[model samples]
Target: MQAAEWRESIRNKKILVLGLAKTGVSVVKHLQALGAIVTVNDFKPLDENKEAQSLIDENNARVVAGSHPVSLLDEDFAFMVKNPGIPYTNPMVVRALEIGLPVYTDVELADKMTDATIIGITGSNGKTTTTSLVGEMLSHASNLEGQSFVGGNIGIPSLDIASQASEADRLILELSSFQLMGASEFKPHIAAITNIYGAHLDYHGSMEEYISAKWRITANQTSEDYLILNADQKSVFGERQTNATIVPFSSTSQQIDGAWYDQATEKFMWHEEVVLDRRDLLLPGNHNVENMLVTMAVGKLLGVSNEDIKAGLAQFHGVKHRLQFVAEIDGRRFYNDSKATNNDATITALDSFMGPNDRVVWLAGGLDRGNTIDELGAHMDKVHAMVLSGESAEKFQALGQAKGITAIAKAEWIEDAVQKALDLSNEGDIILLSPASASWDQYPNFENRGDRYIKAIEALANPDSL
Candidate 1:
């Protein structure tokens, strides 16, 4: 029986959830009803996550909330559901794998639990925008089961409900290299890579390691499967062999196949066949153009009609925290780009930094993962001034000032960073929070960082201050 069936069964079972993150909480909620006793563990202290406290209390499950202990897995339950964020080398998880207990992510659970035809999207950047676009493009994608869930990596474990999904329709998954690295017996019928760039070197420990993980999207496909590749990715643009039929998309060059950029009109040429006005895309930046092409190709391959694709793209709103606009505060616009955790993403954030009056007070820096900033150097002049924070703050400040790009270093906090950006920003200036590093130093993750930035900006905007 699948998770849904097991939950309703009278037989009690033991299951260990290896992380108490957001997805873990959702999985716990569902498993509790299935008569499975779940023990939730994490690297943070038991009381660290206040939001999770109420959940732990309600679920009545044992909590090993700080630093996963190998002892927790001591010959434990039938299986373990690993969170995507956890690394492969984790000692506790490694021990579980050695014991021959099945270990998998919420994605694998979702895949096994549901009969939905999965369309998995992964790449170094642009995944969130592309995933949301594809999900919006074909809301009608439904499995014979008559239901579908669209999520993964971008937040929400869409696969958690797979076992009980009625429609189990088409699933549009936003996959990450980290998530793909640990997967086994997991394959998407339709897979796409928006583009790949230097990112997550710390986790993978090398660009080669990173690229190897990205390629897993198409590793297990059969000839009937569809593989969408971004022709613009120099690392993976050319010379590819896969069992799946290949579909390519790009915004930089026009060549042989699936999707190409029409430089003249700034629109996407589908199948190198039809053109859609680029300006009509709701998302901004050259990066987004590349992402939309992937979505268009996948959408059409999945049997979505041209009209349905148009409807989805036209109605699609960009994902939150990826250049999400809050509002104008004190004549300065605020943007929450906490999703721009690495240099490649921040470059995309900066690409969209050009303001109406050529003014941008950039808020950059965080737990620098060691990805080089040589690429962003060319856009220095576009940033009028930078308000820096986090461990990488000083380094970026030095780089900015050295390049003669006006810069300032501030205490490592979003409030201080926002205030400093505002102090230096003039009317028509954009108060941008596009930190180029991970937010783990002061926040749980990017979402927490994005939330704090939004809250701080709101408080400051309405302050009765001096």
Candidate 2:
């Protein structure tokens, strides 16, 4: 729909926005501009929330703060615009659903405002890297009808991008299961599920629910659209049906009709043509090779040239906090894989850095989600020393001791962990921050934790600091 028609449809409609963050504030601004009567709600007190105060003072928004009172339902809201992170079981949300009021996330709203061809990517991991790679590949394509715009869970709000996006643009979105769960009419022209694994059980309450939420990305797709499925995890999905054409990508098998890595040639095969050689990639890990398979599928479908795809891969060096290389101090190299918030991700990080003789001073631990360290059992051999922190520090310490790691120490938090890790490292050792748990216990998010780690490393590397 055009902006005018969208505005007309929502004009004068009473909408309730749940949870106040940057995205929540954006939702309020857009709705208010469209003449919608928006009631902004957040758990933070009004005095403590600068966003709420500004909304009230600047836009005259109906600000409800300090709680998510179910009583707000008395206002007879037409529907709810919810922050993706807020669970559906929240009292207000549960009550709203009980009354049959429609609830949607800003991603749905963003979809309705733009005519751009959307490439939505989601997975248990590799979402950011694959989305970013596709964006770079398409950006290098000189013949594309549209420019590439990347957003969603990767950082920028989709609404902000959708508002400015034209028909001659492709919005490459990195979606989370949380964001996908709330998206109803948000179908992309091409959708990709990189892979699925057990994750976010706290939010979804179960692995089945988490997988279901991720599967929603393909729910609205038709034969006219394309769906990229990770061939390795085909068994997990088990003959699920979707109207969209399935483009299977694999790192271990040769796909005659889709995208795959040809083990014999050491090349990424896109429908029989070699798009890229694995050795040419700057990013490490087999997980990244899997990511590139998805990217190759998306690039091929979008008509990106092989040369441009190769160029994109050559220049890109992975995203921040996901196996990103920091400065080298003395002979020890530091890597920030702060985005590795789960065991599978951390295992991938460990596998990426493992070599014949390289020892890793592994800095890990964070919010305890009750995940088992069983998967890391075999990989623990590479950990020369372990500096743990956060809520999961004790759990990790126990695991380290169980694995017979001689150098196991706990720190108060990430900064302290970094210092202890530096002290434990040898001249040739790799200092890695690949926390196997979420950062919420000590930091607001993984990005803050990663920034702190980077800052600590930089501070230690300064010559004048001594």
Candidate 3:
């Protein structure tokens, strides 16, 4: 169906929007504009929810704040729009599903509203960085100017850009497992799973369920579409089944038909064609090399020139809050990797600085997402000292002790953790904030947590007395 027909179908339909997060608010506005009777339910009280208050004041729809009353599900609602963060275990959601009401996220709505060529990217680690690099590479492609829209889980609601996109445009989305769980018909022309590791188990309830959710990105794809896989990650390609054309990219395996790094010549090869040399990439880490390989493969499929691909890789510095350089003090380098909200991500960050001279004064810990810190034990030797913070601090400290890591300290807050890391660091040490947990314990999100870490570093650089 076309956009207009889809919009007309929802007219006068009763749509219950659960949660008042950014995506939920966008859904409310979009549905209201489509002439639907929108009712919003959020756990936050009206006084605490600015989004709810604004909608209530505007009289756009009925707003129920402070609680997700089960009675709301009793209403004659046609379907429900859910915020990704609201798990299926929520009483209202569970009841809604029990009653046969279809659930949808903003991603599904975006897909229904546009005919754009969507390129969906997802994984445990590297989603943001790979998505950002794909966007940059496409932006530099002369043929794709004014024809690429980038957003989704990377901080922008896809619905915000879906309406503006045309059939000629390409929508690049950074999809999360939560968003994918509620998606049904949201298929991309090109879908890429950067690499999967155990993550979001608290919300997903199990590793199998988490992997299943990640695989949903390709559920709607067909043979005409392309599904990118990580050949280096054996688990990623082991048991996965997809109808879409599988394009495997690897940092180690040169035998792959898709993109692969040729270690012998220090070049990136795309099916026997040399795309670019490794030395041209500005981003650090082998994980980043894997990301670039995926980006280059996607670019090649889109007919992007080798020159544009090389230029884009050279120009892109990496995403904020993902191993971003904050500042240097007394020859000690600090990096903000607040986006490392899982053990796998923190492990990747730890591996990034594993050289003989690279000693990391690691700052980690945050909201425990029901995952053990034991996986991080393998990388603890790289860390000279660990200054932990937030709800998982004590747990991480215990894990560090078990791993035989000396100089472990726990701080009440991120600022104190930064100071503690600074105190333990010597010249040439790397201070990294790669929390292997979520940020809900002390901040709204990872970006806010990273901003606070950056601010704390700035304050230390120019003390009040100075």
Predictions in order: lDDT: 0.75, 0.87, 0.88
- Candidate 2 global lDDT: 0.87
Q: Write the per-residue lDDT of candidate 1 for residues 336-391, one digit (tens) a residue.
A: 88888877677777777553445778888888777676677777567778888888
Q: Which pairs in model 2 have colliding backbones?
A: none
Ranking by lDDT: 3, 2, 1
Output the worst ten-in-a-row residue range by lDDT, candidate 1.
140-149
Q: Which stretches of candidate 1 lie over 4 Å from their true place?
A: 1-11, 43-56, 64-76, 140-148, 160-164, 234-241, 325-347, 353-466
Instruction: Say which prediction, candidate 2 or candidate 3, comes out ahead on lDDT.
Output: 3
TM-score of structure candidate 3: 0.77
Tens digits of lDDT, candidate 3, 1-466? 9877898999999999999788888788878888999999999989888999999888557999998899888889989989999998999989988999999988989988888889999998789889999999998898674678899999888888887898889899999999998577888899999998888999999988998899999999999999998887766545778899999998888567999998778799999899999768656678888899889999999999999999888788678888887777999988988998998788888998876688998998889777778878888777879998888888989987887778998888888888999999999899999998999999999989999898899999989843
**Which residue ranges in model 3 land beyond 4 Å of their true spot?**
234-240, 325-347, 355-466
Candidate RMSDs in Å, in order, are: 6.1, 4.6, 5.2
Of models 1 and 2, which has the larger TM-score?
Answer: 2
Alpha carbon lDDT of residue 166, candidate 3? 85
